[model samples]
Target: MQQQRWWRGATIYQIYPRSFLDVSGDGVGDLPGIEAKLDYVASLGVDAIWISPFFLSPMADFGYDIADYCAVDPLFGTLADFDRLLARAHSLGLKVMIDQVLSHSSSEHAWFKESRSSRDNPKADWYVWADAKPDGSPPNNWLSIFGGGAWQWEPRRGQYYLHNFLVQQPDLNFHNPAVQQATLDNVKFWLDRGVDGLRLDAINFCFHDRQLRDNPAKPPEKRTGRGFSPDNPYAFQYHHHNNTQPENHAFLERLRALMDQYPDVGALGEISAEDLLGTMTDYTRPGRLHMGYSFELLTEDGSPGFIRRTVEELQAHMTDGWPCWSVSNHDVPRVVSRWGQGSTHPHLASQYNALACSLRGSICLYQGEELGLPEADVPFEAIQDPYGIAFWPTFKGRDGCRTPMPWQPGNGAGFSAATPWLPVPDAHRALSVATQEADADSTLHRFRRFLAWRKRQPALTAGELRFLDAPEPLLVFERTHAKQRMLVAFNLSDQPQSVALPDLDSWHADTGHGLLSGHAEGQRLQLPARGVYYAVAPAA
Candidate 1:
C-alpha cells in the first residue's frame, strides 16, 4: 500500500462531531471528546477519520455557516484541543480530515459584514451581490436548498445577496480573484497544522454563472431528487446557473496546486447537481480534486438495479477520475431505515457496509453504522434542522440521522452527562456498542471482520470493476487486479436469489461472514437472504 496516497481505496469513517460524544457536559460533542475516542475509532480498522465542521459559528446551520475558518468554536473547544485531537488520531495510525465549508459563510462573519455594509468597501466584491429588478424581485430565479428564493435582501447595501442554502449563509463571490486567494489561504492554514486531508463541503458551489441567467424550470416528472423535498420550491428549477459552473474548475485547479505543496494531503469534494456523475467526473479529473462523492446512493431508491445503473453510468463517464462512495452520512437518513423498509434483519447494515467498501474506489462509513443503528424519530418539537422545519409533515429533516450515538444502554447513551442536543432513540440503545462488542455474531463484529478481510484482498480494494449480468434483487460483478480476479455477488433483497456462474470448475469461495448459507453447484449459485459471495479465479 502507498503511504502518501493512502486515501485511494481507503475506508474513511465520518464523525458527526456534535453527536459523536460530549465530554463538555454542554449537550454538544467537542474536540476533547473526539480525542478520547481515538482508540475506539482505531479499533474499527478504518484508515482515516473525517470530522464534520467544528469551526467558529453562530449555530445558524450548525457549523456549516462558518464565521471564522481558522478558529474553533467555543462549543467544540479551542485550537489546542484540535491539535491534541490530531495528535491522538495520528498516534492511533488514523489520518485526520476536517470539513472545509468554503462556498459560503455566516452573515455575521467579519468579511460578509464588511462586504454588505457598502459597495465601495475593500471587501465589497467578496460576496455575491446584485441589484434587484424594477418589481423589487430577486436578481434571478434561483431557489435555496433550504427553502424558497436563493436571494436575500440586505438593507445595508440595498442589494440582494445570493444564498444557495440558509439565508444566514451568504455565498462568496469566487469571480473575484482576491476571494479565491483568501479561501486558499484559509485551506493552507489547516495544511500547515499537519492535518492529512480535507472534506470540501459543497465544492461545486464555489462559482456561479457570470451571466446571472435565470435557471430553467424542471419538468414535473423530474422534480424529485436529493437535497430537497418534492414540496420544496428548490426542486422546481434545473439549478444550472447557480452551481457547477465552468469557472469552478480553474478555482479547483488553484486549490489542488496549494494541496500539492503539502505531502500526503487529499481533497474529497461533496458534489450535487442535475448530472451528479458528470459533475463528479469533471471535478475529480487529474490536477483537480483527488476524490468526489455525490448523493446518488444516498437517495430513497435502494433497488439493486438502481445501484448497478448508477455505478455503471459513472464508470462509463469517468476517464481518470476516482470516486468516493458513501451510503449514509450526516445529511441523509440511515441506510437501514431508508432501504430496509422497516426490516430489522441483523444482516442489513452489514450488507450495506460490505457493498459500499467493495466498490472500485474510496469509501466513507458514517459513525454508528457499525452498530447497525437505525434512524431516530425526532418529533416536531425537538427538530433542530431549519430545512426540516420548513417542510414538516411531508419531510422530517435530518435530525433523525443527526441524533446522538448510543455507546451504552443508559439514558444518555454514554454520549453526554447531561441531555444531548437531540434525544437518543431507545431503539439505538438496543444496538449500543457495549452490547454489540460482547456479541461476536453482532453487526458491529461483522463490519469489523469484513473490513479487516477486505484490506487483505487486493482485487476488492484496488482492482478494476466490471459488472456481470444478473437478475433483479441480485448484483454480480468481477474485480480484476494484476494477474488476480475475484467474483463478487450480493442478494440485495430480503428474499433468496440465485445467479449463474460462467466457470465453476476453476473458482473457489473466499470464506467470510457475507457468504452465509451460499453455495455453488456446477454453473448455478444459490444465495440465502442478504447473502454475499466472493470467489477467486486465475486471471484469464
Candidate 2:
C-alpha cells in the first residue's frame, strides 16, 4: 500500500494548457495539443502531470473563472478530447491531476446568474450576498487581491456580492451545506471519468468569515510579502476576515473522505492565507488534504538565509503533514530570472532544480522550467492579461512567465501554426526542445539525467531531512531513511567556494546525478560556481 501511493515524494510537472501547445490552429492550446505532447512529458521522468484549468469559462481571469465544472471549454476542446488525453497520460505511466477552482465561479455561470436575479430565488443564498450600509457603502472593509473593495453592487438583489479576485468571479457561500455537497458532486463527476488527482485552487478561501467583520489594518513596514507590489492596497490589511476561516477544516475533511473512497487518489491544495505555514500544517493534517503548498519560495527573496529559514520554519510547523515545494508556477516569474537577480547564470537553473527536488517534500516543476526559460518581455501593446493591463508599467502582470513553450529554433517553434495567445520569447528559441535534444550539455538533458538518477535513491526521495549549518551561498542538508543516509550541499553563487565536511570517514561523493561537479577530499570539499555535492553514508 505504501509503494502504491504515487504522490508521496513525487515530482509533478505543471502544464499551463494555453502556453504548452496548440493543435487546433485557433490561436489557443487545447486537449488535443496536450495529448500530442504526452511522449515528450513522460520522457522527463515525472510521476504525474498537473494540467491547469481547462473548464468552461469566459477567460476573464483566464480559465480560473470556471463557468461549468463538469464540461470542457470549447476554446480548449470537447470532452472527448479530454478523455483521450487522460487515457494517453495513464498509458504513459503518469497520473493526471486537474485544477479545481471551487472557491468561486464565473459570473456567467447559470447558478450565479440565478442567485443574483432576486432575493428569494431558488439559489438566492448560493453566493455571498449582503445588504449595503445606510450610507450605501460596502458591507465590510474587505479588499480584493487584484484591486480595491471586494464587494460589487448587484442591483436586482439590492445587495453587494463578494469577489476576492475580478468582478466576474464571484465568491461562493460555503456556509450553505447544500453548496458543499454540490462541489463534492462535481468532484465525483471527474473521479468517475478516471481522474487520478485534483489541484485545488485557493482552497483556503472556500469559507470566509461568516460574521462579515472588517479586517484590521496592517503597518506599512509589515506589508512587504504575499507576492503583491508595495503600491497595491490589498497588502495594507491583515486579511483576517476575508479568508482562512476555521470552518475550512470541516470541508477539507469531507473532501478527503470522498477522495479516500477512490484508490490512490490525492488532493493537493493551494494555500495562501495570512499565516501560510500554519495553514499548510492545518490543512494537510490527518483526515484532511493529502498535500499542501504555498508561495513562500515563489517570492523575490531567494537568499540562502531566506531559503533556509523558510524551510526550517515550515518544517517546524508541519511536523507530520506533507508539503509540496515549487519555485515557479503560472503566477510568478521563472526561478532562473527571479533568483538570479534579473540576470542569467550558466549553472543557476541546474542548481535551483536540484535544490528544490532535494528538499524533503513533493516537487512541482512548472512547464519550461527544465529548459531554464527566463521571463519574457511582453510589451504593453501585446498584453492580454487584465492584471498586467491594470498595473501597466510599475508591476507588469504574470504574462512574462506564461509565454508559450518553444519547441524548435524556427519562427513558430512548432507551438502552433497560428500565433499563440502570448508571444514566444526570442531568447527561448535557442533553448527549444529540438535544439536541446541535440546538445549533450543542455539544461533539458541535465534535468532529465538528474531526475532519472534521483528516482533510484530512496534517501533523497522519501527520507527525513536535517539542515547542516553553513554560511550564505551554501545550503547543506542531510537525508536519512532507515539504513540509508545521504548528504546534499548546494552553492547558490556565481563564484567558487569550499566547505569543511564533518564526517570524512562516513561520506563518499555521489557523481551519478551528473549536473554539477564537486571535489571531495579529506575535510575540505571544493565546489565551482553554481555547483552541488551529493554523498551517502550509513544511517547514524
Candidate 3:
C-alpha cells in the first residue's frame, strides 16, 4: 500500500498503555508490551495507532500531566523501549501518533517548581500567576474543569496559579511567547525522532481569556454535564472565559508550521468544548490542524436520526476541513454497552459498529472495539481515574473502558503473567481475540474485511457525503467521487423495515459481500432488524 499525506481519511486505533498489556511483571503496561503486539494491531488493517501518553508523570492524571516533555516514563520503560516500539510499528507499515499534552504541566515539572519557588525567580512568569484580591479571594472567578475555582494559591509566591484540571496540573500561560516557543520546540523534538504525528490533548484549553473575566452561568437546560463530572460544579458554568479562547488559532498555526516541516508528520486535535463542531471546523481549516474530532458521537445516543444529524451538521459546517469521528475512546464507555440497550444482541452491535465506518470521515477504533466489548463494571475500590472517583456512581469513571485488552481466555486474559491492572470483564473474556480470530463472521473479522474493501473504494474513503432523505429509524446516504457512487443505508431499529429507492434505473446490492455485512436491492431494499446495507448505484 502506498502512503497518503491526508490522514484525515485514515482509520486510527487508540491504545491505552496501562490497560493495553503488561509485558513486565510489574503489573503495568510498558512499551515492549505494545511493540510485541504490533502484529495484532497491524492485522486490524487500520492506518495508524494513537498511543496515549507514556511520558514521565506522577500518574496524577495518568499521562496527561507531563513531568518531562521529552522523556518516556520509567514505568512505561525507557526511551529506548519507545524507539523500539516506534521502529517496529513503522516497519509493520503502521504510523505511530503520540499524545501531546500542551495545555498544562504537572506542578512537579522543573519549570513549575522553579516558578513557584519565588515571585522573582527567572521562571516565575512561565505559568499563569495572579495576586489575590483585597478580600483574599482568587483573582477572578474561573473554575477548573475538574471542579471548583481554577486558581490555586501558592503560599511561596503569595500569588495564585491557575489549574484547569487537577490541582497538580497547573495551566501554562501560552500567552507568553517563551512558553509557546518552548512547547513548539518540544513538538519538533518528537517530530525529529521519526514519530508519524501528534494527537494534541486539550488543544482548545491551550489559551485562556487574557482578561480572566468571570465565566457566565450556563442556562439550566444547557448544563448537561461534560467530561469533568456529572455532579461536579464545573458543569454549571458555560466556560466562556476559561477555555476555547480565540488566541488558540495563532498557536495552532505555529504548531502546524512545525508539523509541515516534516513531509508526512500530521497533527490531530482533541477539541473538548461546548461548541465542538464549530471548534473542529476552525481547527481543521487549511493552515490549522490536519484533522479534528468532537464528542458528538461519544454519548449514549445511537439512534439513526442522531447519527445522521451529526454527520449532516459536520458536512454543513466543515467545508474544506476534514473530520475524524470516534464513538468511543478511553474517556467514554464502549459503544456496545452505551448503545446496546443493555442487550448483547449481535445484530444491534453489528449495526452500531458499521455506523462507525459509514460516517463521512476517518474512523477511530478503541482497543477492544473489535470484540464488541461492553463497558466493564469496575467496583469503586478498583476505580483509579480521579475524574471518576470524584463523581462515583453518578458517573462510574472511565476505568470501565480502560480495562486490559483480552488477547485470550488463559490466565490474565493473556495480557500478563501477574494480575492485570484492571480486571477484564467476564463478558469480554469469552469474546477474546482468540475466540474472535477463529470466527470469520466476528466483529473483528468484519473490521478487517471492511478496511480492505473500503481501501479499494475511492468514493467511500475520499469522496463527499450526501445525506438522503428517508423515514425515521433509517439512515440513508451516498458517498461519491469522480465516477463512483456508493449508497449506504442502515436500519437502526430492532424490527425489519423496507426502503424504496427514490429514483433508480438499476442498483446492485453489495451487502454481506463488501465492507462488512450489508446488501443491495434492485430498486427497493428490505433491511433486517438493525441491519445495514451498502450498495453501488449504476453509472448515470
TM-score of each: 0.98, 0.99, 0.96
lDDT of each: 0.90, 0.90, 0.83
Report the number of backbone clashes for model 2: 0
User: Would you give me the overall lDDT of model 3?
Assistant: 0.83
In candidate 1, position 153 carries an lDDT of 93
For residues 290-402, write the lDDT of model 2, one tens digit per residue: 88976899998888889889999999999878889999999998889888885567678888999999988999999999999998989999898888788778778899999
Report the C-alpha lDDT of model 1 over 475-525, residue by residue, as the tens digit. Answer: 889899986798888898788887787886578888764325467988998
